[model samples]
Target chain A: MIDYDALLNTASTMGLRMLESGAEAYRVEDSLQRLCRAYGADSCEIFAIPSLLIVSLCDPEGHSHTRVRRLYRRGTNLWQVDQLNSLCRAVCQGTPPFPEVDGSLARLAEAKGYSPLLQLAGFAFVAAFFTLLFKGTAADALCSLVAGAVIFFAKYPMERHRANSFFVNGACSFLAALTAIAGVRLGVGQNLDKIIIGAFMGLVPGVAITNFMRDVLEGDLFAGITKLTESLLTATALALGAGIALSLLGGAA
Target chain B: MMEIFTGLLLPCFYAVMACVAFCLVLNHHGKLMVVSSLGGGVGWAACLLCAFTGSDIVQYFAGAVAVAAYAEVMARLMKAPATGFLVVGILPFVPGGGIYYTMEYCLSGDTELFLTTGIHTFGVAGAVAVGILLVSSITRLLREGRAPKNRHLGGEK
Candidate 1:
């Protein structure tokens, strides 16, 4: 018999890990998989709400890809006996441990999914784009890009989760953008064209744009809108950076 | 001439490294990295090939196709989602900078140049999309047709 309390706690830990990892959408699914295994429950499927509540409430301005799937076990699979109802009972009530269960459960948890790092990379790319547009100088744009890249690279050494890593990434972006602008104004030739081009070098809308169109084609208006909104916000941030920097300079002059 | 090559090389390298890093971070196996890199390389190579040949349309379509193929193959082998690989792998080939510049033109109040650049950007995006769709649809059709054979070969009950 599985200790229900212990199982839930473990599941919650897995959930926290996923959230910290910037898992976008697959976090809940992966967590549920772990929880089901721990409880010796047969098959379980996790349905993540399409609304950004899961990710945004935790870390606003963070981007996550969302996914939904159905999981089931075939014949002779240790956990296949209990379906959704039984699994719910196990989670809510104490279910006896099934000693016959395989060791795959622990293996699943240890499987590294660099969820948070990916999100940080995406954020840094967007920040770099914005810095270039706003600074309107090649040196400033390059500095911002380098700064963002360095912050992202630092994630390898820090070993922190997504939220903290992104906070660092955002700080680096702001600093890089500010520094670049200051440096350019000091004497460097302000090359607007190169700055704009370099900033956008990292902020390609490949995933969002493709997914938005795919969702629309698949007749998923809700999903499409969600993706579209996320993409627009990132783009707006890029535009805002450039617009603000230019306006500030104009005002000063 | 060398300036253009240098310009193209940096972006291509960045695109390939980003795709590989994404795969590695996802904890996908070494096989996935190899396949994705190969695909990305092929796509970028197509771009350079196009530049040499001076055929923009062919270059764009070929690059998109190569990437789509790479993504499909990797997804099937890794049993993971293909979206991330496809999106990041083909990013270098996209005309995002062109679109940004077009918008900039309009923002700076150069409407005529903005219109021209905007149209050109859209044209590039449309061509790329078509190439992607073509490759994806073909791969899907082939997979569907071979599903029974695959199942049989795998000895599925």
Candidate 2:
């Protein structure tokens, strides 16, 4: 006999994982429904927004089970999304047993991303190259590189403590602008605007904006609005932080 | 020649590097990193190639279409979700600079420039979104046409 309870648990867990990793709302809803149906669910209904997921399904015996997951933390971990996508595809195709599905999900969750040092390097390269793209001089790129490193190191701990995203972005951009201004003051960089813009790219809501469009296009109006708000708030935070820094230290430079 | 190199080639090269860096930040691993970063290059190149249109909004739109189409094809080949490619590829076209300038104008008390820049920023963002919408909609239609059985159900109203 199919274990409907275990099936519900696994399906909901997968959905939660995908949502946390920033899968588009439609993808999350579609995946959950597909998984439940693959396991012989007679009917499945999934409601997903950026901040919550509700999944309900009925077994052949007419018993209904529902799982509600309140999501407080959302991040763009595309690797996790890709891993879960493949796992979902495999399970649906092979009709995998419950134990196997549970184990795979556990393993995938524990998978590590790049190490801290590498992530730091990633931050630096992103800042530096974007400066060049914006027509900053070589010295400005170097300054933005240092500013990016500062932003990463400064923001990492607050993020670890689960600080409010807006405050974190604001504080990071404040630091970025401060660094850029100091770089100009010290004669290490030219073009203050270019340096700050490069540093800001690290904090920009590019992923949020991209996902926002996709979500809206997929007809997930609620999720789309949530993402749009997130992107807007993030941009505001960055600007506020940078604006304060520029006003304070900008005069000295 | 200098214009071609600086205006066209250099930005695309920077786009590739920046995207690879972004892949690392987002924890995208394996050969997918390089493949997806190439999409960023394709996007910026498309943007530059369309420069004759004399409108930044149109440039962003062209770039988004190229990136979306590339992401779709690559997702099929790699058996991975297209989100990774789409997110990273479109980064070059995102209005990070526009946002900065808009905020800058607001902070500096240039309401006139602020309004214009902010509206232009929104226009650019809308163009990118519509371009993505257009391509993905067509791809979905073609996919459903080929495989009616695979059409998604139960989610839409």
Candidate 3:
């Protein structure tokens, strides 16, 4: 007979470990695979909802790194599985996560047609286009571009450690705003609203809100509450950064 | 009208992008992607609707409800843990304004205003929590009432 209690305990422990180690959604997913193996389960899927705390951790130099790996059993062979990575970079600094796993997984997932560099370049370019379009000042645009580049470069790290989605977006927005503010101080465009709008582009919590509603409708109250809390917090973080900047600027006025 | 749409478009797109990012993070492609994208779309639409109506309370409630509904449905359909999806999907709809106001009031040395805003922030959070609880209780009752009967359901089949 299978030891259900032991399995449950192990799973719970793994979850707690991942949470404590600052593992984001992808890390949690990977951890779930490992947990399933420990219990001799054939297959498993895991998802960690974007929480405010998780989002806040997306600051480029906050907290330590955590790695989670998942193993899948195929007949007599145990194979490695690739988990999602979240990359959060500040301006031109920082590195991405999961280079090896990302490459391997892309190869396996797309056998004959895997091109990680191309995909990454495409994402970077798209992000840059949006940044330049919305940002009213060169400084703001440059900051956004740099942040996007950093995101591309550090994509593997961000994904591997499971940085918070909200945090990554919020940080990018904050940096953009900071750059715009600096531009204003340096006698650039005075379109505060445009800069504000541009900076806020990355701070929306659409996915979290949707998931919150879904969980509520599905009658999973605990999950719903947790998701709701997370959504609220990420929003708060964005607001906090903006509010602080505005307040300081106001004080000078 | 165009200005309003423009105002809404950037945020909506950003929200969608965030959702896609989350999907990538979770390695959810195929049907899961569709579900997540729909969830994101609904949430963004709610935000725009709230903005158009110019009602803060309405926006908050609408966003919360829409997101909660999206998450719950996906949770049931996917038969996976709902928390991950719920957390990620609702990222765009949080009440950032109230939080900013509260923090600003505090930093500006307006204790009364700060306290008031702080309380308001907590109230918003509480409201969201209550809504989640309400939905969850109803779901739990329905689940229990409709539980499948089986001999192998108990301790040792």
Q: For model 2, how does the per-residue alpha-carbon lDDT over B1-157 read when each residue is reduced to its tens digit?
A: 9998989889999999999998888999988899999999999999989989999999999999999999999999999988899999998778878888887888789999999999998899889989898888888877765532433532564
Stretches of candidate 1 exceeding 4 Å from the true structure: A1-49, A52-180, A183-192, A213-221, A250-253, B1-11, B18-31, B52-58, B77-79, B145-157
Q: TM-scores for chain A, candidates in order? A: 0.43, 0.97, 0.42
Candidate number with greatest TM-score:
2
Which has the better DockQ: candidate 1, or candidate 2? 2
Candidate 1 whole-model C-alpha lDDT, 0 to 1: 0.49
Mark the 10 consecutive residues where model 3 chain B has the least summed lDDT: B148-157
How much does each candidate deviate from the true structure in C-alpha RMSD?
Answer: 11.5, 1.9, 12.7
lDDT of 2 at A30: 78
Colliding residue pairs in candidate 2: none
Q: What is the interface RMSD of each candidate, in Å?
A: 10.8, 2.0, 9.6
Best-performing candidate as measured by lDDT: 2
List candidate 2 segments past 4 Å from native. Answer: A251-253, B1-3, B146-156
* Candidate 2 lDDT over residue span A44-105, tens digit each: 78899989999887767788888888999988898999999989988988987899999999
Reference-based TM-score of each model: 0.56, 0.96, 0.50
Per-residue error for A169 in candidate 2, Å, reads 0.8
